[model samples]
Structures are given as C-alpha cells and as structure tokens.
Target: MSGHVIAIDGGGTSCRAALADAEGRVLGRGKRGSANIFTTSDTIGENIAAAAREAVCDAGLEGLPLKSIPAFLGLAGINVGERQRELAKALPFADTKFVHDGVIALQGALGDEDGVIAILGTGSVYLSRAGGVSRSIGGWGFAIGDQASGAVIGRALLQQALLAHDGVREHTPLSRAVMKRFEGNPEAMVEFAQQTARPADYGAFAPLMFEHDEKGDVLARDILLDAVRDITMALDAIVFEGCERLCLLGGLAGEYRKRLSPRHSAILQEPRGDALSGAVQLALRAFPPQAVGENG
Candidate 1:
C-alpha cells in the first residue's frame, strides 16, 4: 500500500472513505457522519480525516502519513458558488481533488464511458459526460432544487396535507395519512415543516409516498408523477446530448426506473460500480504507480 490513495463519497448522511493502492484496488472502507459542504462544511474536514484514518487502520496501514497521501473527494453542492474553494482550502490532504459528488457517481457507474447519472436520494442531482466533457444540472440543495429527490417528495407530501387541511385541495387518502402522522394537528405539521425539518427529516416521508402510490392513492400518485417528470426531463437533456448509457442511483432509483417514460427504458442499464469506486479510479489516474514510485 505504498502509493495508497483515499476515495471519499462525501454525502448528506455519511462520509464514506475507501483506501486503495496505486492500481485502484480497494483495501479498506470507513464511514462517518454527513460531509455536505452546503450544510455541514464546518465538520467535513474533520469527518473526512476521521474516515480516512479509519480506512487506513482498517487496511492495517496505520503507520502511513495521511497528510502526504493523495485523496479524491466527491461531494455534493461543490459546484455551487464558492463552496468548492472553501472546501479545497480546508481539506486535510494537500494532494486532493474535490469535485461534485455526481462526478464520482458518473465515474463509478460508467468508468469514463459516455453516460448520464441521476442520483435521487434525500437530495437529487444529475450529471453527464461525453467526449471528456462533464456537465451537471440541478444540485441547488433542498430549499430551491433537488427535484425528484426523496426530501422534495417528503416535503411535497406534507404540503399536500396542509393544503387539504386549509381546503386549498381535496383531501385524499395519502394526504390524510400524512396528517395522521402529526396527530391530525395542522399546527404541528406546520412547526415541523417550517422549523425543525432537515432535508433528511423531510426525506423520511418518501417511502410513505411509494407505499401510498402502490395503493393507488390520488395524492401520492400525483406527487410521484410530478417528481418523475423532473427526472425524465433531466434524462432527456443528457440523452439528447448523445449520452446513450444511463444509470439511476440512490433510494428512489428503482421506483423511478420503473416509472420513467418508456423512451428511456432501452438505454437504462446497471452500474459497474458506485461513487467510491469512481473516486478510486480518479485517485489512481491522478497518481499512477510510476508517478508514486514502487517503493513509496
């Protein structure tokens, strides 16, 4: 493990790290709390360091100096504003490339081949690659973006319930079910939605949307269909750009694959690997065996 590198999938719920040698073989893995630059930038460096240390220890390479090792971090919201610079400045590793989490996802899934990735978890983001060019769409965090995301679905479900309560919309079984979670108290729902809910907190309601959709609930179907529209549009943009291979990632991936417009079904295929795998690929490319030297 002389020329080992760290590959990190810096996510909203957890930071996952993998220790890999110059050849891109993973030797160990580690996980820690959220590494979101948008919401948890203060702790990302600490979390990443801890996770990398854990990975090194897991690989029985605790004697190595982490500061000298190269690392590739794939993080969410890195493309927005100055977040990338702020993170790059704060990173513990001097040899590191901090990129959009979607970059790693695309690499993991496609391995440098032209393709598209739509990650539809607590938050959502879409990325595409073609002819060595990378492009991304919609990763603005939960407040304004994250379309087709679990958090968005959950928040929308709650909104529907509130709308029904106010006579702004018809009360459906799905809406009633949501209201019931708050003990039928509109005020309680308001308090949670407006004050206490994080993206993950709102994303907690996504499974319920799926469950109700299966039962043919009107509100659930409506909300899910709307979310699918967002995903479909993103897919369309990339596919039209000449990316024929498509891989959907995250919690809502399967459900969305089954529901997307039939036009995309033929291009959909399974991923070869995940974001961490892609990180290792990037790390290996950045520091090859010849570059690192065989003896470290």
Candidate 2:
C-alpha cells in the first residue's frame, strides 16, 4: 500500500485534519474544536491528536502505523524558536513540523510555490512565502493586534451602539441589530463579551455587519470597509519582494469576497489545499524511506 500523509491546521476556532497520499490526493478529512495552544493548556498535543484521529477514522483508516506517517501542524501559538519543541513530543508522526497557523494557511493556499495569504477568521494574520523565504504581519493576538477580524468589528459595533445610546451618534441599523443579537439585554451583551473566547466567536456575528452595511448603515459600512483596508495593508506589508501571487482565506474571507476591492481580487490565487491537507502532507513527509519510496 502507498504511504499516507497527515496535515493539520489547528486554530483558535477549530482543528481540521486531512489524510492524503504522496500525490496529495485526499483520503479522509476530520474536524474538531479549537487546538490553539495559547488559548488552551499544555494538552495541545492531545487535542491535536484527537482531531487527527477523527480525520483518519473518517477517512476509513484505523490501526494505521503512526510512526510511518508524516505530519505537518499549523498551530496558532507556536512560534519559530524553541516553543515548537513543546509540541514535538505531542504529535503522532515520527517527523513533524510546527509553524504559526498563518504559515500553514499560506502553505495550504500556495504549497511550495511562493505567495501571500490574508486570513480573516476568529483571528487575522498575513503571511507570505517566496523563494523559500517567509514573513508575517499582524496576528499579535486579540489584546494588541488582529485588526481586521470579527472580534475587532464586534468590539467596534458594541462601542458604536453604546455611543448611539449616549446620543453621540445617530441611531443606525447596527444598533438595532446588535441589540437584537443580545436579545435586547445589555447585561446579556456584557456577559457574552466576558464569557466567550477566541476571535471566531465574535466573528460569528460578522455577517450582521455586512447585512447592516447592505441596508445602508453608514457605521457598519465603514467598519466593513475598514476591515478590508486593514487586511489589505497587512498583506501589502508581507508580500514577497516581487510578489505577484496572493490569496485570501478563512470563513470571513469567503463571505466577503464579493465585497473586496478590485485591487484585492486581482492578485488572489486559488488554494492548492487546506490546513488539514497541509497536515497530512506534513505526515507523509515523515514516512520511512521504504514506505514513502524515498527519504522524507
């Protein structure tokens, strides 16, 4: 039998895994909850394994040799230096690689090819890889950065609503929509803000911003437009020195694709794979030489 590869794209919102052959043809796909190390505990390896196992099972494989598998993980909090070691002990494959989720996203979108990816989801980040060199922009987390994200937009919406309530701005559709989302209870709104975790939770409401904008809410339109601007700027910052390839990925990115400016759309490229596929690709690279037909 041909060897298999496992790729994982673990993020603040969810974990996805894909099983594939050396040719990159997919075998199975699986999904689970967030596997972000910074947001969760030291059990990140366990969580990632669970998600990968689920994908493997979904692909109708069991009792497979884990050691022979090659795996790649794009996890949210793992940086380039020593922090990756913490994850090395936890993954299933004999050989595994870890990078920031953005790098994984970029790889998924472009493979070994060079390009940039602007990801907007529970979090926002810009990544570019060209001529085997890579760079990043933003993705500092919710506290300091993540400018063009759902949390940022949600926070802005709430702030604007409060301002409207205080008569600082005129009433708008967003105020009504925001109030409705929280069931018209300010306390519930506060509770939602305090209790929820991750950028995706707030991003869940991103559609409302678009809807409000479509309905002619100036504030909502401004917020949406500004989000695009922020993402574009981040992309511009990291694009390869001679970049001609770029792509936008994520739930929000797909939803807002039609609304993106022509300049943004012109450079977009289709993704060659997904984070899960990238994980499987990583896994395949770890396979034993005899099994993979070559040294990984």
Candidate 3:
C-alpha cells in the first residue's frame, strides 16, 4: 500500500488536489480545470491525474511515483451515471475511492456531527446526516436539476437578456450589460448557450449577477429571488427537526446565505473546514501513512 495519500475535491468548475503525508499534513496543492463526470468524463481521469501531478510537483515530490498512491476522489455528477467507475479505472492511482461531491462537502462542513449541507456552486446539491445515516435531497446537475446553482442563475440572466432584447420584458441595466457582452446580438447568446457553453461557461456570469445585485439592479434581484426559492425548498426537505448544524458551501454559498430566510438561521454557521480538508482527513483514516520516508 502507498504510504502517502492524495485527496481530490473536483466539480464542474475546477478540480483541486492535495498531497499529504501519512500524518495528514498537506505538503503541496494543485488546481486544474473541470472534472464533472457528466459533461467532462472524457477528461476526468486526465484532470485528476494532472491535478495530482501538479500537487506532487508543487511539493517537489516528483521523485515519488503516483501509481503507488492511494486516492480519494470526491467529484461532481458521480451520482448520475456509471462514468465515474470507468473514469477511475483510467486514473493513475493504485487504489481509489469515488464519492459524490456532496459527500465531501458534508464531511467538510459538519465533520462527524450530524448536520446538513447545501452546496451552491456551479452546480448544487443538498445532503443531511443524522443518526449514523446520510441522505441526499437533490443535485441532478444543469441538464435537468441544479435549480439554485450559479450555472442556472447565469443562464437565467442571459435568457432574460434575450427577453428584454425581444421587447418581451423591460430591459434593466443588468440585461443591457448582458446583451453588451454578446455584442447586442441575441444570436451570439444562443450559439454560446446552445453550441459551446458548459456549466462553468454559464457559471462565469454568476459573479456579474451578484455584483449587479449589490447595486439593486431589478433584473439581478428577480433572478436571485427565484434561485433562493429553490434553495429554500431544498433546505426545507433536508433539514431535520433535530438538525443542529446547517452549512452553506461552494462558491455561491455566502451569497445564498444573505438571501435565505432567517428560519434556519440559528443552525446556520460556517464550516470548520473545506472539502479538501475533509478529503485529507478521510484519506489518512482509510489509508494510514506508514513511517514517513520516500512515500514507503
């Protein structure tokens, strides 16, 4: 068995990896592009390996062979299909475990304590753990679900831009700005959203929405209002009666928190750590490091 462990927290937006010793001390970290199995499965293995390679090289451990390492990959879109299993087979790790991205987010948010986590990133998912059992609420991804995700929010903005352009709706400043990005051509938005855009591509527009929201742009307010409703519905389903912890995670987490109702505010709090931290902890437990020397 490899004495060293590799931990990954990958999603539609990016893949992050950490190299740690047996004692779970992080030596180096690396980041790469999307690892979403649903849309990017063809390159999932490559992205994972590339991130791992970068981590090792970042730590100046290029001398250690990756094929001998054990890895834990917490990836997005693993629940929708069998692609994760196939992707794992192509990875360089000697032993690897696959889990839904929400699993690691939950672990990072609540640790061993039973609680709930709503990951609101480029994609979204909700998970709750209680009484030694865990359950998932939603996370169907962009094609079908992911209602409260950045991708969804951004797509809605562009779609609204088209609505404004066509005179179906009043064009707010936010809509005008969106149209400007497309060079005032609705066809460009169509081509991008329909032909070439991935979830991250849409998600890239999320920050602009948030920025516009802060300025009290009517279009931004409307979009976030709808997204928050989706978040509330999911939270209501996943939060149990005795739930003590409720953590909002991912890139849009804090933004959503500001918009959500105060109903669960008492339980809502910051996570002790992040997904990568949880991955490292799990890695050390599952594959205990041997006496630290040349990665054993």
Candidate 4:
C-alpha cells in the first residue's frame, strides 16, 4: 500500500479519489466538496490534500509514510498548461500528472483508445482523442458557454421567466413554475440572484425541465432537445477522424442517451469504465510493478 497510486476526479461539484494497486484493484475511495479551480482556489490545496489523505487512509495505508506514492489528478478546467503545473506543484503526491477533468473521465470510460466523451454535469465539456492527439470543445465556464450544462439550463429557464414577467413573452407554465420557485417579481428576482449562490446552485432545476419535456411542454422539449444537440455537437467537433467510438459521461448524458440524435446514437459505443474506474486505470498506469514484480 505504501507504493500505491492515486487517481482523482476533481470536478466543479465534488472531488472523488480512488486508491489502487499496480494491477488496478481499487483499495479505497474518498469524496469531498467541490474543488473546481475556477471557483474554489481559496481552499483548493487543502481540499486536495485532505481528499488524498482520506483516500489513502480508506485504503488502509494511514500508518505508511507520506511521499510514498505516485498519484494522478484529473482536474476540471485544467486545459491551461500553467494551471496544471501549479496544481502538480501544490498537491502532495510524489509524482503527479494533471489532465483535464474530461480527459480523465474519457480515460476512465474508454481506457487509452480513441473516442469522444461528453460530460454533462453542473457544467459541461467534450473531449476526444485519436492517434495520440487530443482536442476539446465548449466548457468555457458557466457564464459564457457550457452549453447543455445544468447551470445553462437553469439560467435559460430563469431568463425565460424574466421575459415573461417583463411582458416580453406570454406567460406560460414554465414561467409560472420558475417564478414560483423564486417566489418573486422581476426586481425581487434580481435581488435574490445577487444574494444567492452561483449558476451552479440553480442547476438542480434542470430535472424539472426534463420532467416538463416528458409532459409535452414545448419550451421544455426545445430546451432538452437543444441540450442533446449541443452535447452532440461538442462531441462531434473533436471525434477522431477515423474513430467511431463515442461515450457519453455524466448523470444527464447517460440518462438521456435515448434522447440523443439518431446520428449520434449510431456512433456511440458502450463505455468500459467510469471515472472512478478510470482513476484506477490511471493509478495502475502510473505505478506499474517491476518487470518481475508480483502484481506486474
């Protein structure tokens, strides 16, 4: 256990860590609050350290020495090189490899093979790999982009409500539901938003839209359709030229697979693993046994 490898999925809403051996057997797992660098740098270092410690302890390695293991951290919004270096230097792992959250999620799902992975969480992103080349689309934070994300859906619903309140559109059941959720008029809505949490806080409303869509609500159907299309477009943008495998990750994407466009459906293949399992894969990759080691 002292020579264990750790894999982390540090995302916007939560961080998950897995401890695994050279053969990819998961020894332990741990979870913590959000660790997105974009929003939580104030405590990112401590959060990572705590998560690692917890994971190791869960793996029954609390008595072992520190700096005894190599670890791989898959972080959200780590597309920039500088950020990767900063996080690697900041974390406590002996040897650390940093990659985009989507990249690791893709790896978790597809191993080292070429494929596209679309993630639909509080935020959204698409990643693809082929011939050792990698590319990504969308995931530009919650404000400007992140199409198909829960935050975006919530924001859209709120905006539509605002328009209805301002007489910009006819009031509909969706608008009514939104207004009721906030319990306010236009000015009150603004005040509530100012004092409330971020766009992510509203992401919980995404399911309501889905429910409405199932009930044949036109706007809800449009929103759901648009989410599927956006997610597909993001995946389509980066799928390997010759690769035909596509894997959708995240709660929403996996659940809505049946709703995806037929063309997208045609290209997708089943994922072999999840992010946690991918973490185990990454751990084994980082800490392979000697050519003659027992687990090798």
Candidate 5:
C-alpha cells in the first residue's frame, strides 16, 4: 500500500520489525540479529533492511519497493546524535525517524499521557515526561551506568565470585556455582571475562543470580537487593520529577516488581502498547495522509 508503515525496535540482542497499515493495523512481523549502534553499527543498516524486507514479504508484499515505506526505528545506542544521523542516512526507507529506544518505549507505554518508565533488560534507562517536557535519568550503557540492569547484576555476580575465590568475601552457593562454571579455576574465569566483555555477555549470568536467590543464596540475594536499590533510586528521581504514574518495561520488570516497595509498586501501571506500536505511531505522525499525497 502507498501509506504502509514499517516500525522497528532494535536493541543489543535482536531487532524486530512490523508492517502496519495507515490505520495502525499490523500486517506482518519479522526479527533479526543485534542492531545496537555501539555493538552492531557496522551491520545495523543491513540488519534493519533485512528485517523490513522480511516483514514486507511476510505481509505478502514481497514485490513492494522498500523506498515507498515510511519507517520509524527506535534503537539502542542511537542517543548519540551523530550516530543517529549517520544511520538515518544509510537506511533504505523513503522516510524514517530515528529515536532513542527509550523514546519509543515511553511512547508505547504512556501514549499521550504523562508518566515515567524504567526499562530493565540487558541494560537500563529511566525516562519521564511531564507537561510536554521529557527528561531522562540513566542509560549510559553497561560500563559506567545501567544500574539495576541485567548486565550490572551479572557483572556483580562475577565480581563476587572472584572475591569469594580470593577469600575477600564470604563464600556462598551462588559464588561456588559460578566458580564451578569455570571449573574452579580463577584463571579460566579471567580468560572468559577478557574474551567476552560485552554487556550481553555479562547479562547472560543475570538469570543465575535469580535462580540462586530463589534458593536463598545470601550473595545472590545481596546482589539482587543492590540492583533493587539502584532501581528504587531512579524511581524516586522520577517521582521527584512530578510524574505520578510509572511503568516498568523489559525482561526484568516482573522480577523488579516483586522487590519494589508497595509505594513504588502502587504507581506502576500496565503499558498501553510496545515499542513497535510506538514506532507505528511515529510513522503515522511523520508521514500523514497529506504528506503522502493520499486523498481521503
């Protein structure tokens, strides 16, 4: 169709695309590999294009020229203006808007309403909107920030494991298990860490902390509590920013909900939609009927 919209949600782990009509009816969907600007910038264009093409084909529009599609991409690591501009120029779509992944998440979660959202996944970011003013707290990526994120939790687990090995910290089943994963060899752990320093690599260990926490592992519980504290701090900041509504998004949201205080939890609301839906919303706004020369 002339006014088809292609919405993309791109992150460190995977990229998802959905084809939709002007009325916001979804037609088809597709998925592909990582599209994080910092991690996959070299191939992000190819990845986005591939996902869009697949989505179009899935919509039974295999012969459609992609340049006719208006797209919105909400991507991780695109907060850098230069990177956003560069990637926008490289994409194959006729018209496209590049926004921080958090923007789409906020749009999807709150629509036109005012609120705050904390995204806790392989990374974390806090975004809030009030009186048409948008403010962000974190999401500096895994290295310096992203507290309460899976990557942070996972990295903490590894650090505790090493500390336990050195007798600098109390040992626990969780640490022992982590050490066992490296065959009780600290050198092996070091080698692995050196080879796999990416946030996704560290985030792979996050589930192990949860698993051990359920078993009452002290270290694991401590790590989780630390993460919770970080998340709570961000929530407090959002509240101070005048946002009364909060929505938690991403893989770890549920885990965090249970750990949050009742006061904070009370503010949490279900998201109105997802990032892809928000992207479709953006596409519709950016390429309205008049812009597309479409008659009613």
Candidate 6:
C-alpha cells in the first residue's frame, strides 16, 4: 500500500517529526528527546521510531505500519558515513535517507539561495552554500568543538564558579548562584560534574548565564562575551568565504543575535522555513511520489 512521507529533524536536545502526503501537504507533527548520533546513537532507532509513530498517530493514521513509510532523517552527529549507515539500518522505514542536520537547516533557512547559517544550541556548527558548493565548519561535537554552544557556555560557568570558590576569581551573581545550587560545597560540584557530564547537563546552565548577563553580572558578561567572540569569528569566516546572506538558527541564536555587532547582524536574514520543513523537502526530493510507485 502507498504511504505518507516522514521527515525528521533530530538534534542533541530533541527530535521532531512531521507527516506529509504525496502532494507535500503536512498532516501532523510530533517530538521526542535527544537523537544526537554521537551521544545517543545506541537509542537513535527507538527515538526516531517513537517520534515517527506519534506523528503518524497525530496524522489520524494510528496503527499504521511504519515499514510502509519513506522517511528522510536530518540528524545531528551523523556526518560520518559509518554512523549514517548504522543508523539507517536501524530505522524501521522501508526506505530512509540520512543526512546531517546542517543540510536541512541550510535548506530551510535559505531554500536555493546562497547563504550562511550558524546553528548554536546544545551544540554549534556553521554551514555555508554558494555556487552549488556547500561547506561546514566546526560541529566537532561538545568535546573539542561547538565552541559557542550552550554546553560550552554552561561548562564555563561551572568552571568560573569553582574558581570563585577557590578565591582565584572574583565571585559574581552568576558564579554565586552556581555555588548555591551545589549548596556551597566544592566537592558537591565536582561530584555532579563527574557523574553527569553530558552536554545537556552543562547546557542546562546556559539560561542562568543569560539571565545573569541581562542583570549586569560581570562574570556572566565575561563568559558570554567570550562566546560571542567565538561566534563572531565563525560569522566572519562565512562572510570572507563569499556568503552575503546569513541566518542564525537554534536555541541560542536569538540570544547571540542581540550581542552581535551591527556589522555582523546587518546580514542576518529570516529563515524560509524550519528544519522539519527542510527535511520534508529532502524527503520529496529523495522519495518523490513516482519513485514510491504512487498512482496519480
């Protein structure tokens, strides 16, 4: 039997799915937890399946067999070919196309136009397309890259908190708040860091920094300024590479936008659509109705 198209935008923080008919009309949507291949590859299949199932149900097609669907997954941390193949095999859909999440973000943000996009959320990556050539910068994961990401900002806050506790750095409202969360015990902070060092755990502290920055906290300002510098560097590189239009995407995009210099912000353009829409676009490109054997 013929089936609907499924498009997924899977990231380190969450996975979103949408169902669309042959005519490219969206029927329903669903969401689930992290699907980052680097951190959650072992459970990626389950996460994708759960999100897809919910979207199908939301589309009023509950109990439909997932194997009948053709899905396109735009996922984080699937840049490596081996990882892509591994996750593709694990998915339940009869036909699946797996591409890095940046691809969908670019497609959604710029359509066929030449531009650059900086994705700053739980992790960070910069992508640019011009003259049919696409290039990616950073996105090396939270460990070595994602320099201006929430995870990095949050980790920096914790480090500053510890420095303040040690008298090596001046304590500000932001660092004090972090210390308070650990009950003023340095050991407690160490224990928490050792036990739960995931990107999301560190990313949880990002909002607090933003809040403190708005309140004029020196430490928070310092930390965020450093992040802004990193992001600005990436943006500069994109412009130097010949991209005239730029878009900032993800959770931290809005926050960073406010901090950017006018020169950098001047080129920012609103995205044409979100990542899910881009994934659906990719789904249509890869699994058009004719290719799926649909009868007109």
Listing every candidate in turn, what is its Cα RMSD in Å to the true structure after a full C-alpha superposition? Answer: 1.9, 3.2, 2.0, 2.4, 1.8, 1.7
Model 3 quality (TM-score): 0.95
Q: Candidate 1, residues 9-98: lDDT per residue as tens digits?
A: 988778899999877889989999988888787888899999999998999888887887888899877777876776667676748888
lDDT of 5 by residue, 94-168 (tens): 888888889988999999889999999988999988987788888888878889888889888999999999999
Please give the lDDT score at residue 113 for candidate 1. Answer: 88
**Local lDDT at 121 for model 2:** 79
lDDT of each: 0.86, 0.74, 0.89, 0.77, 0.87, 0.89
TM-score of every prediction relative to native = 0.93, 0.85, 0.95, 0.89, 0.94, 0.95
Q: List the residue pairs that clash in candidate 4.
A: 108-278
Quick one: RMSD of model 5? 1.8
lDDT of 4 by residue, 57-167 (tens): 998889754377787878777764466667677777777777778877888777888878888888888878878677888777787888888888887877777988888
Residues 20-52 of candidate 2: C-alpha lDDT, one tens digit per residue: 766667778777788777666566677777867
Give per-residue lDDT, candidate 2, residue 156: 77
Instruction: Give, for candidate 6, the lowest lDDT window spanning 10 residues.
Output: 287-296
Provide the lDDT at 141 for model 4. Answer: 78
Query: Comparing 1 and 5 by lDDT, which wins?
Result: 5
Q: Model 1: residues >4 Å from true position, as ranges? A: none
Lowest lDDT 10-residue stretch of candidate 3: 287-296
Select the stronger candidate by lDDT from 1 and 6. 6
Residue 102 lDDT in candidate 1: 89
**Rank list by TM-score:** 6, 3, 5, 1, 4, 2
Which tens-of-lDDT digit does each residue in 232-272 have in candidate 3?
Answer: 88889999988988999989988888888888777898998
lDDT of candidate 2? 0.74
Q: Model 2 — TM-score against the truth?
A: 0.85
Give lDDT for model 6.
0.89
